[model samples]
Every structure is written in C-alpha cells, then in structure tokens.
Target: MDNKNRYSISDQSIRFLNKYLNSFSPTGYEREGQKIWKDYISSYVEKIVTDLYGTVVGVINPNNSPYKLIIEAHADEISWYVNYITEDGLIYVSRNGGSDHQIAPSKKVVIHTKKGLVNGVFGWPAIHTRKSLEEKKPNLDNIFIDIGAFDKKEVEEMGVHVGCFITYPDEFFIMNHNYFVCRSLDNKIGGFIIAEVAKMIIEHGIDLQFGLYVVNSVQEEVGLRGAKMISHAIKPHIAIVTDVTHDTSTPMIDKKIQGDIKCGLGPVIGYAPSIHKKIREFIIDTSKNKKISFQRLVSSRYTGTDTDAFAYSNKGVLSSLISIPLKYMHTTVEMVHKKDVEKIIQLIFETLKGINYSKEKFFID
Candidate 1:
C-alpha cells in the first residue's frame, strides 16, 4: 500500500461497493440504495440530504457561492415490473427503465414484494423444442419468469404481485484482477466513484471555498428524472457528470458507429451540445496537467445521461461528462477496467483540486 492508503480505495470501500452494487436500486425504488450511499458517505461530508424522489446529496461545503460545484452520478439501475401472472405462475414483465429483454433467457432473477424477495428464473424454450429456423426470438412479449409455482394462486401465496420490481441476482465481481463485472454498473459505479471522491477529499484534508454537492441521483435510466429535480434544487454553477460509455472495441460493436473507445484505455470525455465547451476544455486541461490519459467522444442531440439534465437546468449550469468505458451495458454483466476507474478518479479529483473560484472562469469567456 502507498503512503496515501486511506486516499486510495480501501478494503472497506470495496465491501461497500459490492454491497451497494448488489442492492436493489431499481428505477423509482432507490431508497435502499440511497440508504447505503448516505451511510457510507455520512462521515466524509459535512452534511447529507435526500430529495423527495430519493436522490441523495452529500454536501461538503454548504454555501451560496457562485462556485457551487456538483459531482454527480445516477443511482438507479434498469429493472422490470410484474405486468401479468399466468395460470401456471409464469410472470410477464414490463421494462422499468431500459431493461433489455433480449438478454432475459435463462437468467436468474429476484422479485421484490412487500413480504420479501421471491426467487425466479427467466425460462426459455429448450433447444429441442425450438425449431431451428422458426425459433422465436426473445422479445418483451414472450419473455417471462417462472417462480416454481404451480398456479397464480401459489405465486400470490409467495407474495409476488403486479407492479413489484424484479432485478437480476447477479452480484459484483472482479475479473482478471482489473475488470469490474456486475449488473447495474452502468450508473451505480458512478455513485461508487463519486463516493470515493468524497472519502478521498476528507482523507486528503482538502478544503474547498465553494460548495461541493456530491449527488447520487435516482431514475436516470428512466430519463434523468432524479437528476432533473435535484439539479434544479442545487442549481450548481458547475456540474461534472460521470456515467458509462460503450466499449466499442468489443466484438459486434462497430467502432465507426459507436466511437473507438475501450476499457483499460482511459475515461471517455464527452463533447455534446449539452456539454459546455469552456468547462469541457477545463476538464481536458486538467487531464493534460495531471498526465491522466483520456478518450474522447461526441454526442449529438443529448449525452443520454445526467449531463443534459444539469446543463440546461437553472440558467444552464456548466456541465461535462467523464465516462467509464463499459462493455455489455444495460445487461447483467457490465464490465469496466480498474485502470480506467483509477484514472477517472484521479482526473476528477485533480479537476476539483484545481477549480479555484477565485481564479477560474468556468464558462464566462
């Protein structure tokens, strides 16, 4: 371990990361995950507050300075909700937030209910039963979950009902010692990374003149709802958003179409209409000054993340994106490289460190 062990990610933080990522923070139902986030970041910040929709904010320097800055990431993961129950207890679902039905076959899932969780599996037709050419593709209409119940009555007895959320049972994992593989890493990893930033700031004893709002937003997958409400409330002058981008180097992904980015290469900085050019340039400058390698990409109409929410809120808060290159996004086995994770943390930390309100004009040219 280095001399700055506490500043580095500790074993305890890793434990928290696993638990947080494993928890059910499905869209519109993020209270459990918000509790986890608030508890973990409580000691690191001066104050903590949650909005009506369960968006948690850890405030480091609560004040009214024009330099108010927000480091943000969404907390919700894509999920499904029970839409119907068959006579034989098979459950049909509707996407809660961009939940991919294409990957549903044979995957284990857990149905959340008022009573508790009921285990289930997404069942598909056996290969023998499926005709080679006439086999039906997996789609929202045909995908369903079986909970080992004989009838709908038995399923009801087990406490599952319509509107109850369902999530994958897949847990957090590290592959090849550097790749983080897990469900919901799309934005939950963003929450983890921002929390680590707060922890490091406390450990390093760095004080900021402006308020640092560390926001873990909810319902971003459902169209940035969580960030929308909270960003309007915080009205931060500068917002730095972190979320995942596709690892186009992976098989089946066309680099020309998705942009040439890869995990273990570096964090991807997004240029978009929502991204303020001056603030974006500031991040690029920070990456260069700190010698942190970074990749670049462009988003046309929207960044498809929380950056759009904050950028256009409250007279347009300066916003930019720092994305972790992720493979298999919106799936059970989302993967990100530990090296890029480290660089993203370093880059954001350095940017925050160098953002001196007294000397910095983030957007004003």
Candidate 2:
C-alpha cells in the first residue's frame, strides 16, 4: 500500500483520543493529561524530554540531525478557579483561561480538591420565579456552584476551598458518528493530531533528515506560556502549530465577523503575521499534491494561538498555523468533524515527508 493508503486511523487511536480528551487538563494543572499523552506516544518515538513547567516533548531522530522541526499543540483546557466561597456555601469562580461565563448555569462540574473529585452544579433561579425583564444572566458574579454544603465552614471541611480548579464533567462522545464533541477540543485535539502523525511516520518506517519535536504544551489557556518557554529552549528551525478555530457556521456567530469556516469542510490554514510565507506555501502545496481539502483564514495582527509564541521566539523561527475548525469553542459542547481531523493528520505527515534541505530551504532573499 502507498503512504496515503497506509495511514489510517485505528480503533486503538480513537480509544486513546477519547480517553485523552475526557481527561481534565486545566491550565497550570496539565501533568495528568500530559502523562497520558506521553504514554500513548512513547513507543512511537526514540526519546522524550519534559520541561520544568510540564510541557512534554517526544523527540524523533534525536541527536542525529542538526536541523530541528516542531509540530506542536497546547494541552491545557479552559477551566474555572474557585475565587470565593460565600457564607452560605455558594462558590464563586474566576476564569482559569477564558472560561465562558455565559455557559455555566445549570451545568455539572467537578471541583478538584484535596480529598478527590467533588461533584457540584452551577445553580440558577428558575425562570418562572423571576421577572422576565429583570432576570439576570449567568455571569462571573451570578454563577455559583452548589455542592450540597449548608455553610462556608462545611464547604472547607469537604475539601472545597478557594484556589481549587473546576472543570465541566462533560465526557467525549461522537455525534451521528461524524462530530467529536466535548470540552477542551480547542487544543486536546491538536495534541492528538500531532501524536497521530508521529505514529504514522514511525509505524511506516519513514526516515526524517531533521529532528521532529512532537510538543504537548501547557498554560496555553493562561497564555502561550509553555510554547514560549519551549520554543526558546529547543531553538527549532521550523514550527507548525495547530489549534482550534471557530466554526462560524453555527448559530449566533456572524460569518462576516468570523469568516465562513465550517465543521465538515476540512482543516483551516491561517494567514497571519506569525506565518512564514515559504512554510505556508509549502503546506498549501502539500495539501494540493496529497489531495487533502483545506480552508483559508486571515488574521490581521496575531493568530492568538501558540503559533505566535513559536513564531516570534528564538530570533524568530519560521512558523505557520493549521487549525481544526470547531463549533462552540471554549464551551462544554465543543464539536469537530472527524474528516478534518484525519485530513490534518495526513497534511502534517505528508508535509514532513516533503521537507528536504537540498530541495527547499528557508530563505528571505
């Protein structure tokens, strides 16, 4: 079979993706999820290195090539931090990484505590009890967690206190066998794609002339903290960053403001200040040659993903962004198309196969 035919998503991969996506990996607390990811990719890579902040790197063809290349994704997910526990045992929260306040009401949550997982629910008054015109919406101050505690002292006694990390209790599932839905797809899917690409290259016995860094970064929900630090340390010659973009085809999103990205179309290639022209063209060419479908996006200033972090780091490495179009990003029901995921994996794998120093070099002449 040819390389294209040989690369296929197996049942084991789907199982891994489900497990990894279901795992909680809130910002600054990504160690557990990172361990799961590292374990999955361990047998497929030659060596692995971890940073002080827990950004995991699986190295391919390590120490054999001077040129370094990176295919990266952030592992952290948007979550909430317990800001204050009221005297009546209601828990007010703050954003951990752009956690959407509007979606909090009536949702189930897991508050990570010293004891273990504490179940809670975001409480809201029934619409019938409130004046429709005067009804307040779910916001930072209004949304609170009810864990069945009667008082603040009981809440603390139950191991729930300020600074505890909170995440939606939503698990991964397929919709109509086409859409992958769950919280945190903004980036756990990115990590999954890179891992799949690495698996394909290794299982097929494909040799690379340059080093490949499969990076699962942390603190992206807070900022591009992990990517910033790791890019400087690795000093890679080229970087390909992947993350989720909004599927504007969904309701309430204006296509004029957000462009016309959709779930089932394909992966989206971004044009941004951080994107290197030659690298961008090469990726587009690879997509065309391999017959992989893709969409286009333009970012005026920044891509707002780790692409900026890696692109501007280490005296400016050549970098570009490829995004998986997702619906309801940052919400518990975030969804993506299965075909886009597979195509992205193929695009990255094929692009890497075509990168030869003698044939194509990064030059600005």
Candidate 3:
C-alpha cells in the first residue's frame, strides 16, 4: 500500500481507538467495551467467541493447524469505583487498577451508576488549607468526587451506588503532526492493532501455517488475570503480548534505564527471557527486510505486561512482547505516535507470516 493508504488505515484505527477510550469499560465493567469490539470485529473474522470472563476471542484459522498462536491485548482500563457517599453528596471512591493519584484530582469523570451515567469531577482539599509540609503529594484516600448533588440521599437517588465504575472523561486528540494523546491508550491501542491485523489477514487471505487467536482480554492492569486464564486455555505453542511502554520524553526519566524507545520511532520489540529468541529474531528480520522502522527494548526482569502471565501459563508458553512506545503512561493524557501504531500492525502481520512451527528447538541457536 502507498503511504497515503497506510495513513488512511492508521487514521481509521485512531477513530476506533478514540471511541473505545471514550467508553466507560474499566476493569470489572467491560461489557460496553466488549460489545463495541465485538460489533466491529465479528464480521471481519471467521469465528468469534467470548470467554467466561468476557474476554473476546476472534479466530481466523481454528480447525486446520495443530499449534495455536495466541495474541493478547487486555480490554480493561484503569479506573475507580464508588466506595462511600457523604451526607453532603460527595462520593468517595477507590481505584480499580494502576492509576496515578496525582493526576486524579480536578479531572472530569463519569460514574457508571446503576441507573445511568453521572458526570463528576475529582475534588480534593485546597492548597491554601494545607500546611507547608502537607502541600506535598496528598494521599488518594483523601480525594472525593463532587457531582453537584445536594446530599447523600440525593446522590443515591441519582443512581450513584457503591461499586459503580468511574473513569476519566478525556477525549483523544492529535498533539503534533504524528503524536496523539488520550486516556487508556495503554491496551486499547493494542486491541485496535490486533483487530486491524485481523482485518488485513481476512482481506488479503494470507496463508497461515498455524491457527491464530486474537484475544482481547480483561483485567490486565490488576495482575494479568485475563492473560493467565486465556493462555492457560489456549495453550499455544507461541504467544505475542501487546501493550504500551514508557516514552520517557518528559523530564525526570533516565534514558539509560529505560533504553532508547520513543513515541515517534516505531514499535519496540521486547527482549526478555520469556520471549522466544527465534520469534524475536524473526520479527526483527522481517521488519528489516520490509524496511519498516522499529526499535528494541531490553527487559532484564519480567516485563510488566501480559507476556509475564503468558510465559508461565499452563506447561509454559514461549511468549514475546510487542510494545508501542507511549508517553505519559497510566495517566489521563497518554501519547503515542500514529506511525508507530501502523508499524506495530505491520510488524505483527509480517511476524505471524514468518513463523516456523515445525522446528524442534524453541529458540534460534
């Protein structure tokens, strides 16, 4: 495809990403997100299935191959849940996943209550009321959400119940020429990439030697729970875990510590023990041969992604991580490059075509 066509595809994917990010589908509350993903991906793939935990699994080659190839992207995003309602109508909430408390205060949010969606803003004590020492980072527990209700009874009447999901009400926007910012790009972007790959595979009719399973998992931010379950069930010979990594463009980040991955470069091919060396080599070689821009990220220990879960699942699976370099991870305004997103989709499609499942050794020696 030409550059213009490739950019068009990326732009379409960005639209999908925005819609998914804007929806309220945090952690345990993933039904809405799943419905959206299902509706978009159902007609493109050969078959689709939803697991017990609401993980959406799309199968392109289900019957022929002996080995299964599982690609995972979690559907859940970081969010909060209502914990208490004060007599004055203020709602106290507890975080559901890995959320930066510092960014929560003063941000607009949507509470997915029993009756309907109620808009609110995270509120905290003013700086003027705090002592000099207390002006430092305050605890998240002290934060509350104000929805303009009169009292606790009024708030309850508005259908704000305990355990209702609360998420950042941020919309996706293009920052510069190539960079974009939004909430929940961490794995929503990953899910969008997987779906885009599936669409390409279907349109091109690429012959595959192994069965491919594109799984949109749930609750990865908490502890990779969805990956653990799906990997165990699929028991694939090989797996690819897709997620986001730090861009480190802002101040206070050490370049040497996080390697040289950046937002506009391309997707970062992960190098870790859990990642099969042969698969990593195949991906790198394919990117080079295809003349696609790519970057390398080294992880000395376990990568904090679904790869960690898939590595040890069942008897043990050979798993690798393909990360999109993202700035401001786990925040309301996460940023990613549009080129990097397209590169990741191409890399994944090309890597799958290069797999040699009949080999005896797992890693290339």
Candidate 4:
C-alpha cells in the first residue's frame, strides 16, 4: 500500500498552512481558526461536531460503532491577555498560555479588540541606558505593550481594554523551500496534519472497522483544557495524538537534555507512561510495514501534550503519540521540516487504515 502519492504535501496545502498559521487562534479565542479548520475538512467528513469551548470534531463514520478512534491536535496557541491599562495607556498583560516573556519585548503584537485589530509593540529599555550588571531583564512583571495611546481612556477608546487577547503578528514562511517557520506551530501543525489524514482517508476510499474522529482541540497550551473536555465527550477506545517535539540537533540545544530528535528525520513515536504498549507497537508495526520513517521519544511522567489528556480520560483510554520534530518551539520562529510533516500525515493515515480495533491481538490483556 504505497501512500506517498495520496498523503504527499501539495502546494495548495502549503498555501492553506500559511493562511492557517498566520491567523490568530490564541488560547480561549479559537473560534476563527476552528472555522478555518472545519471548513477545510467539511468536504472530507460526514459530520462535524464543535464543543462549547470551540473544540471541533469531524466524524468520518458517525453511526454507532463497537470502537471509536480519535486522531487529535490542539488548535490554540500561547498568547497574552490584557490584565491592566496604565493611566499612561501602556497595557499590562498576563499569560493566556505559556507565552514566552523573553521574546515579548520589542516584538510586534495585535490586540484582538471589539473594534478590530489594534497594533502595538512591546517596549523595552535601551541597552545603552541599562547597567548590564544590574539591568532587569524582560519578564511578565515588567514587559508592557505600547499602543501609542496617551492614557487609559484613550486605550479604551481604541477598543482595547481588560481581558482582550493579544498575539504576535508573525506570518508563516518557508525557509529554503523545506522548513516551515512561523508562530504557533507548537500544535497548529498538529491540527493541520490530522486534518490532512482525514482528507487522505476520504480521497483514498479507505474503510475502517471503527469510527474515526478528526479532532482539533482548543486550550491545550493552558493545561490541555480542551482535550480534557473532548476526550470525555468522545470516549474513544483508542487515541492517536500528534504534537510537536523538540529537534535537539540545532545549535545551543543539548541532545542529552532534549533527546536526539531532528527535523527531516521522520515522525516521532512516543514511549510514555500514558501510551498503551499494544497501541504503540501497532503504530510502529504499521510504520515499518509501510516503510515510513519515524523517530523515538521517551516521556518521563507525561507526554506533556494532548496525549496525556486523552490517555487519562474515560478511565484510561488506549493512547499513542506521533510528533513532528520542531525547532524553536513556543517562539515566533518555530520550524519543522516539510518532509517530516508529510511523513506524520502518512503515518497517521496508514495507521488508521491498518488498525484493527476489534481484534484482541492488537489490544493488551
């Protein structure tokens, strides 16, 4: 079963990836991004289910089945929330997720306001004026956004107020025609891959013994809130989750601390406590049989992605994780190899085609 042609990344898909990654889908404010994902997959699935908190599920086989399978990725990205408006119109923000404070200063951002997009820049002190030995570095406490407003009233007039969400304005771009560099790839790329898997499943006319739920979850950066909710809602018998793992091959990254993972090598298969041994082996077998390239990952206590959310749900769902090796995770310039992304989609697509949920041989005693 050669799936290279069917699951290969196309130019049209790259265009979609650019638009989707450039769109602001900050945590807790994911409706717009979910709409983009749901629209892209609507033609490929029979039914779409959106949770109250904006987790979107596209069901290929909606009818009742003996087993349910969920291939999920989170839609939300780390961002900031407007916590306070200084009298001088400077905006103080709090973490909406795990926003990197070190990268916040001097970066461009957009405040999602009721009026429209309000542009702002994170202000920092000049290096020349700072005493290097005693200078205070950028942190949540001191970092502030300058919107060029005179006072708090002026900021309010611009539709920027407390509780407004902010995200970087970094657009998606490809480097050397291979690496995808952008903000929020931490898991948006996950959503993109799973959606592509569903697309391939429909295009290739593959049949599965169990219902396949293509889930794009929300709020994963903030403790997997969305995955936790949807895992309960779906109650899937088996979950194959995809998220980004660090590519430790880059400069300044210690392989001993981050593990030996690299982009363009292959998809990553997780060895975590939450990962069901049988399910893990099943995916590895499928990858090997299909001649798909994949790397290995070992998680100490938890996989730290949506994998943990679903693995612990429904009194322990059988779960495995497949990750794309990502570089500079959680920053504006997060990157992954195009080959790795395509391989992940292929791996997930092939795994779904070959999985036998009804066969006890694939399940542990």
Better lDDT candidate (1, 3):
1
Question: How many clashes in candidate 3?
Answer: 0
Candidate 1, superposed: residue stretches over 4 Å from native: 1-7, 64-66
Q: List the residue pairs that clash in candidate 4.
A: none
TM-score of structure candidate 2: 0.98
Report the alpha-carbon TM-score of model 1 versus the true structure: 0.96
| Candidate 2 local lDDT, 51-88, one digit each (tens) | 99999999999888889999999999999999999999
Stretches of candidate 4 exceeding 4 Å from the true structure: 1-6, 358-364
Give TM per candidate: 0.96, 0.98, 0.93, 0.96
Which model, 3 or 4, shows the larger TM-score?
Answer: 4
Query: Worst 10-residue stretch by lDDT in candidate 1?
Result: 1-10
- Candidates in descending TM-score order: 2, 4, 1, 3
- Candidate 3 global CA lDDT score: 0.83
lDDT (10s digit) by residue, model 4, range 10-39: 887887788889888999899888888889
Name the lDDT value of residue 234 in candidate 2. Answer: 96
Question: 88-139, model 1: which lDDT tens digit per residue?
Answer: 8899999999999999999999999989999999999998898778779999
